[model samples]
Target: MTTATIAKPWYREFWPWFLMAGPFLAMVGCFITIYFAFTQFSNQPIQEEGLVKRGLVIEQQGAGAARQAAVQSKP
Candidate 1:
């Protein structure tokens, strides 16, 4: 005697769709991230007041050091 068994089509199976879900969701998330990145931020430069203050402080320190060196050199 001989026996035969019938198999279901690939689309009706469970594991193939399960395996595909990861990359599909990842692609969706990637597009969402790209959309938000372009829409949520501005193209203008940031304000520079903090940097200007820092530069002024550095210049004052250099001048103070030079004045101290001049006083020490005069015996």
Candidate 2:
């Protein structure tokens, strides 16, 4: 006994596969783009360690000022 398969109509055929796969492929492309962006950020050389340390110091000083303000605000 031999079996024959029925062919699907053209409009019903490959379009659904594209719709299903399109978003998945687009997401993968987006992931690749984000990965390259992060890599670029990581690759840039920080020219001055002193500048980085000063930034940290400024952040800490700002946090300390906020704490002082909160303490002074309490009755």
lDDT of 2 by residue, 1-75 (tens): 999999987778888888879899999999999999888776553445233333335222445677899999999
lDDT for each residue of candidate 1 in 1-75, tens digit (9 for 90 to 100): 877778999999999999999999999999999998778844433335333233225222445677899999999
**Per-model TM-score versus the true fold:** 0.53, 0.35
lDDT of prediction 1: 0.71
Q: Give the top-scoring candidate (lDDT).
A: 1
Worst 10 residues of 1 by lDDT: 51-60
Q: Determine the C-alpha RMSD for candidate 1 after optimal superposition of all C-alphas.
A: 10.1
RMSD for all candidates, in order, please.
10.1, 9.3
lDDT of every model, 2 decimals = 0.71, 0.70
- lDDT (Cα, 0-100) at 1 in candidate 1: 81
- As a TM-score, model 1 comes out at 0.53
How many clashes in each structure? Answer: 0, 0
